[model samples]
Structures are given as C-alpha cells and as structure tokens.
Target: MSAATATKTAIPPSGGGLSRESHPLAGTGTLLRFNLRRDRVRLPVWIGALFLGTLSTLSSTVSQYPEAEDRRSAAGSLDSPAGLAMTGPGHYLDDYNYGSMLSHQMLGFMAVLVGLMSVLIVARHTRTEEETGRAELVRATVVGRHAHLTAALVTAALANLALGLLIAVGVGGQGTEGVNWGGSLLYGAVHTMAGLVFAAVAAITVQISQYARGASGMALAVIGVAYALRAAGDVGNGVLSWLSPIGWAQRTYPYVDDRWWPVLLGLALAAVATVVAYRLSTLRDVGGSLRATRLGSPVASAALTRPIGFALRLHRGMLAGFGAGLLLMGVMYGSILGDAEEMIEDVDELREAVEKIGGATIAESFASTVMIVIAVVAAVYVVMATLRPQSEETAGRAEPLLATGLSRTCWVASHLAVAMGGGVAILFLTGLGFGISGAVATGDGGLFLDLLIAPLAYAPALWVTAGITVTLFGWLPRITAVAWIVPVYAFLVGYLGQILDFPDWLNNLSPFGHVAKLPAEAMEWTPALILTALAAALVALGLAGFRRRDLETK
Candidate 1:
C-alpha cells in the first residue's frame, strides 16, 4: 500500500553475534585507545618526572660524593633509626657504594610515587568514568561489562612499563661507578612490579565503592599503609617489611641483593587482585558498587543548608586526608634535622648549597629548606580545593544548586574561601608538626616556634597558586590544569635551582621565590603583603569573568 516502504531497511544485527561480542572483554582494545588518548599529557608527565628525577638524583649523588671515603662518611650520617625509617634497611650500608646509596635512598620513595600514579590512572579511567556517566553511555553500545576495568588496567600497565623502561635506560646508560647494567635492570623491575600491584588494587577498590573519590581514597589508603608498614618493619624485624608491597620492592635491594623473587610475588598478587576485581564486577550493576553507601539523615542541619557548609562537607575527606598525611610527612622531615649538620659537614658544595638556601646555623637553614618542600605540598591541596566547584559543575551538581536561589558569586566565593582558609590550616598543621618533631630531635624548645612560624610565610605563595587556578577556571575552564605550573615551577626553582644552576630570574618567576626564606632571614612582610594583594586581584578578575560567561552545559 505504501509501495512496499519504497526502500528495504538495513539488515538488523544477527541473533548470533561475532565470537568476541559476548566475551567479557569484547571492547577492551578500543576502550584502551580512548584512555590513552585522554591521558596523553597526564601520563607523559608522570612517566617523565619519575624518569628525570631518578637520573638527576643519580647525577647529584655521583657529583656530591666522589671518593670512597667520602661516600662512607655520607653513609654513616644516614645510618640512624630516623634515617633507616626514612630510607630503607641498614643492610644496604654494608657496601655503602654509589649504586647502593641510590637504591637504598631512592627506591622506597619512588615506589610510593609509582603506586600513586597507578592508583590515579586506574581511578581516573574506571571509577571517574562511571561517576561521570560516560561509562554507561559507552556501555550502551556493543561493549562487555568488564571492558572498562580491563581498559583501565591496560592503561596503567602501559604507563608503568614505559616508566620502567625509562628508568632502566637512564640508570644503566649512565655507566656510573658502582652501578652495573644487571643491577639497573633490577631497579626498573622494582618500580614496574609496584605499579602493577597498585593498579590491581585500584581495580578492586573501584568495584568496592560507588563513588570515584571514595574508591581513590581507599586505594591511596592502601599505599599509605604499605609505606608505613615498610618503615616500621624496616625499623623492626626484617620479617615485617616483607609483608608490604613497598617492602617487597625495597627488599629487592637492586644493587646489593638484586632479588628477583619479589618481582614474581608482585606479579602473582596483581593477577590475584585482578581476578577478584573481575569476579566482583560481575556481581554489581553499572554505576554501582559492591559496598553499599550509608544512608544520610533525612533533615539537613543548619550548617548544611549554607553554601560554605556544603562546600566544607564536600571537601572534608580530602582536608582530613591531607592534614594527616602532611602531619606525618612533616614529622619524617623533622626527624632527620639532627643529622643535617653532620650529613653536610664534609661536603663543601653540599654545605654551601644548604647555607645558600637557608640560615647561619646548618639546622636552622635545613629547617628553612624543609619549609619550601612543605609549602609546595600544601599548595597541592589549595589547587585541588579551588577546583572543586568546577568538578561539581562538570558533574551537573552545581547547576541545580545555583538554580535554587544561590547566587553564582556566593557559591564560587564559598569554595574559594574554603580553599584559602584550608590552605592556612594545612600550613599551620605542617609547620606545627615539623616544630614538634624538630624540637624533640634537637632538644631546643625555641626550634619549635622558629619552625612553626617559618612555614607560614609561604601562605601568600599558596594563595597566589589558588588565585591562578581560579583565574584559569573562570576564563579558560578547559585548560584549568595550567594552574599546576605554579607549584611545579616553585619546586623546581625553590628546591633544586641552586644545584641545577638555574637562572635567578627563573626563581623570581615563582611567587614562592618572592617570599623571604623564613627563619634563615627575618620575616619580611612586604613580599607577603604584595603576594596577598596580587592573589586578591587575580581572584576578583576570575570571578568577574566567571559571572560574564555562560555556565558550562553539562
């Protein structure tokens, strides 16, 4: 009657699809490509930083301690309980060679970073996708349920392997004294294994929680515990260290023992964890998790109704985590304050560099140097907090809240206030933590006040960092991540500039550079005031821009 529909309809998909269509990992390859594309810049930063850091450290060690006797003296300075807790087992000191020093001192810390990278990579791809509903959209097509997890793991695997190879090539290619090619290969293996183990840990955690942040929090907690266990275990009986993945990585003792079994153990654990994650994935629905979230109160509290209080609630977990983590980190840094003088006494270049960075007394100067590191870390929190509002907007949560009579200015200001206020609190905590530990280690009560006040000087610098994030978020939301450049450059210039022979103007480019090195010199409020004013101007500009622009459609 309609001319037989005029044209034939296209053939429908057959009931029996291709062999791989029904498989659990049908679209994993395609998903992996997407992940790689999405993380191109992010992945390269992680890989390159670790690689370059390792190379520079190795070069620094070689240049700083040339003769065998000098190396022995340097090793003796780091042989204390505090040193062992921070570095690794004292067994590596038996040889006390350059290779051993690099392995013992660097491996433990590097393993933590590698684990973190894997956790973030996996979380970003898997749980973050689910949180944003992208996973559901992609899954609506002919994709398997397990494809996302598989793709995320594959992404992590690629990053870790790339970093491992770089480390191997960097370490071995140098042909430095006391380091062999075989040992260099083992060094890379250590990082590779730790990364895979954490990637699997992330896979399992993502399935355990419905939220991306919760999943990431759990995975990061695992990393913290592993490092703590390694430290305590290394300080105690050697047996305890073996229980931790980080411990296993350290136990490889690249240049000293070069044990291959831990690598195998890591692989076995990765396989087991990955399988468990897959099994659990099958037990849950998309965008849901195995662990149920606790029910909330029916009525909102007085504070919960306000924008400031809501922003605080959203940021509480990160705030607490950063506070605790920084407190512990500050303690570890301070614990080594007692050895700072002895550690640098015999080395001319080293002593000059430390003095150049800080004060008259080596301990005071060392404390001052440590302040920059703490401030850099705190800035990380500032950047993250400042961007929280954008995250809410991108998630479609902010639009609804804004529609309910909350002015955009008030909403944005609330988050910014939290970012700035939280920065102050975190800085205080870190400084206080350093004060307590440094006081204990040196038996000088005055050191406590000196150290505590010293770190606060960087608060203005931190504010500048937050302001940059705000400015970028307002005018250039898509490129907001450029804000990280402020801190990264600060670290490179503030911490390593003297040694690297970086131009003095480069240091001035960072807000941290403008801040007077506290406790080393008297506190200069002029720079602080200038930085504060600059930050305010920047924030205002950003807010103006944000108000004029249309809200991002999510």
Candidate 2:
C-alpha cells in the first residue's frame, strides 16, 4: 500500500472511536452491583428505620384517635394557617380519617426524607466516586462513559422502590379505616416518584459540580426550596402548591381524594431531569464538571493559615444555611403561638402533647418543643462537622497536613471546636427566629429573651453528639456513620414521642431527652451538668485514641 493510504488506514474514522468496546451504559450492571454491595448496611438501615417508624406512627395515630369525632377534633386543630403551613392543605381536614391523617400529617415531610435519601444516594455513588478519583480508575476499564451515573440512578430507584413497597404493603394490610389497597399503592408511589425526582436532580447537580458535597448541597437546597414553596402554597391558594414536587405528592390526598394523577408529574419530572443530566455529562470530561473552575488567590488568607480558622472556613457555608433554615422554622412554629390556645382547645391529643412537653401555658410549652427540634437539627450539623476530619483523612487530604507540624489532636480539635460552637450558635439563632415572630404575635418583647435562653439548655446535648462523632471517628473510623443515629433518633423521639405515646425508656435513650423544658418549666441544672461532663470525657477518650492510631489515607 502507499504510505498515505497506510497512514489513513491506521487512523480510526471520525465519530467511530471505541464503538466496538464501549457504549454509554456498558458495565452499568457491574457498577450497580458494586454500589449496592457498598450500601448493603446503609440502605437497609434507611429502609428498615423508615418502614418501622412509619407503621408505628400510623398505628399510634389510629389507636389514640379511634373515634371519628376524635379524629375530627384533631383535624380541627390542623385546620388553621399554621397547620396548613406546617402540614398540608385544608382539604385533608375535611375528610380527616385515619389514612387522611397520615397523608396530611406525614406525606409532605416524608417526601422530604425520601428526597434527601435519593439526593445523598445519587451524590454518594456519582460525584463522590469522581471526587475520590475512583471513577477515573474504573473508567480505564471496559466501563462506559455513563455507567457510573446510570448505576447510581438505578441504585437510588431500587432503594426507593423497596421503601415504597414496604410502606404500601404495611399500610394496605393494616385494615385501618379509610385506608384501602388502592390508596396505599398511591401513597407508596408518591414516595417512590418524589425520591426519583430528587435522584434525577442529584444526577444533574453532580454533572454541574466537581465535588460531591457541592452537588449534594445544591440538591438539598432544591429540596428546601421545594418544601418552602409547598408550605407557602398550602397556606395560600392551592395554585402555588402545584409548583412544588412535595406539594404534588401531598395533593394526592392518598385516602381522602386518592388523586393518583399527581404521581405522574413526579415521574415526568424525573425523566426530564435524567435526560438533561445525560446530555450534560457529555459536555465535560471525566473528573470534571460542566462549569469551569476559577483560579484561586496565590497566597493563603490569614484565617486559613490556622487549623481552627480553616475549620471554620470549611463549616461556614453549612452553618449559614442551617442558621437560615432553622430561623425560618422557628418563625413558622412561633407564628401560631398567639392562636395556639384557642385552636387547640378541642384537640385533646394536641393538648396532651403540649402537656407532655410542659410549660406554664400552651404557647410556652409549644415554644419548649421548638427548642428540642432546634437542638436536634443543630446536632446534625455537629455530627457533620465533627466527622469532617475523618472524611479529610480518608480522602488523603489530612496525611500531608499531619506530616507537617500540625498535631493530630490539634487538627481534629479544630473541627470539633467548629462543630461544638457552630451547633450552639445555630440553636441560638433558631431561638432568636422564634422569638422574633413570637414577640410580634403576642406583643411580649420578654418572650425573645426567654426564647434565647431556652435553647441554651440543649447546648450540652449538642456537645455530647459531637463527642460521640469524634469518638467514633477516632476509635472506629470505619463505623463512624453510626453516629448519625444520635441526631436522627433524638429528632424522631423528641418531636413525636408525645404524640406516639412512646415509652419513657425509649424517650429517655435519646441524648436530648433529659434537658429541662425551658422557658416553661423551671430550669434544672443537674442534667445539663451531667451531659457536659459526659461530653468532655468522650472528647478526651477520642483524642487519646486518635493519637495512637495511624491516619486513614484513601
């Protein structure tokens, strides 16, 4: 052959590269299996905890309000603007039966949980793989371009399906009044679709961000906005509600109206998002994002030079978000305080729940309840910040720093300090938020001061949560995720223990259970001091362990 013809034959044709070896979805099954195996323990815990907790809540609601009149009275309590904003639309209050009660009280919030799960799962399997550099290694094999994303979406979908199936079967088989087989199916579908939509949202976000945390943060922000839109819409005309995925699910009205069509909206949104994600994936190479990265300053800032300052810098974004979100929650909870007494007069279940929390009056008791929620939410931040060091270590970022002059204790303590201090600050901010709206509603400026101090009682508990995270990271780094149960369990029991008639032992097990119901009951220093001491001991134990163990380097 001629030299030119030989060279031409040696080069592959344009648009024909690797067509024989790889397709967009090649090796998707292999990746999916690997992702599932990695998540074996994690996914089961999510599914089992949500499944059992949901059923238990339903049964408790049914048992407590057996009579129709009782359910109606409880419904009456939820008919106000505060109820509509917190729960769902006013229509549920019309036919408020056992199933309707679950849909109204649970669906909107449950969608949030399911959506969060989807976002985390997608981000964990997709951008996290890229962030860890594992995707580049895997891509060098026969795996295709879109295999990681496809596998992640599949994993999220399967988990969501399992959760939805369990919920449907459990609720449908219960033989509860107003709950039928069809409505149960629709209920489960709502969860499944909502989760898929968020999973798709995460997929799109992963392509837009190079870091897993950034992608997940962006997706979570969407969840927050969706929830806010739903709340606003539910409180106003039903028009705004239609704009939110959460609202779409809740408006299904599961057993009350059994509007099955809204589930299709979620499915449609998920499909469109997935296609967009796939298209955007081609716009960038592996280990990068669609958006271009900007160059940073050549010199380090004075604050970033110190471990504590750097830790604060790393935590500030989340701190700001949590502060803003919690502040709004406080305002919403406090908005109803002025009318709480009059609205809850006939609702015996609510009256009992208020008494369970305990205060001089219904409004004050409700304020105390808000404090518990704020602390628990703040604990979530505490755990995340405490574990930041572990994530850095595993990612191989901490090894070089440790090899420098930085001691392990100092490095970890910096993050722990941020966690401890930020948690308490957000708690205070949340209280101030409550106080702001509450002061205006009731015309009592003193309420603001009382509210600020109310959250202080739980500061020790937040410290304890951070301590637990530190202990796990130091001694059992592989199992550090178990520390999340502290906040999750505390929030669950603290918020619902009264309504669910949870056993005293169950409630007592939460780190947050013992704090005095402040601004209502007299302040008790015993529990606060004990928790504080316990936190100190745990932190010392963790630091000692970290000093001895070798650093984990991914």
* Best of the candidates, TM-score: 2
Q: For this target, which candidate reaches the highest lDDT against the unseen true structure?
A: 1
- By summed lDDT, which 10 consecutive residues of candidate 1 come out lowest? 12-21
The pairs that clash in candidate 1 are: none
Candidate 1's C-alpha runs over 4 A off are 1-20, 347-349, 357-360, 499-501
Q: lDDT per prediction?
A: 0.88, 0.88
Q: Which lDDT value does model 1 have at 442? A: 83
Error of 2 at 127 (Å): 0.6
Checking candidate 2 for backbone clashes, the offending pairs are none
Count residue pairs with overlapping backbones in model 2. Answer: 0
- What local lDDT does model 1 show for residue 165? 89
lDDT of 2: 0.88
Candidate 1 local distance difference test against the native? 0.88
lDDT of 2 by residue, 472-535 (tens): 8889888898999998889778877765566888878987998988888888888989999999
lDDT of 1 by residue, 1-554 (tens): 69888889977567866556567788999999999999989999989999999999999889888899988887787777777898998889999888999999999999999999999999999998998899999998878888999999999998999999889888999989889999999999889999999999999999999888889889999999999999988888788798899999888888898899989999999999999999999999999999987799999999899999999999998888888988888888787788888866765665776778767677888777767888998999999999998988888888889889998889998999999999889888888888899889888788899888888899899889988999999989999989989888899998888656678999999999998887788888899999999999999988988898888767
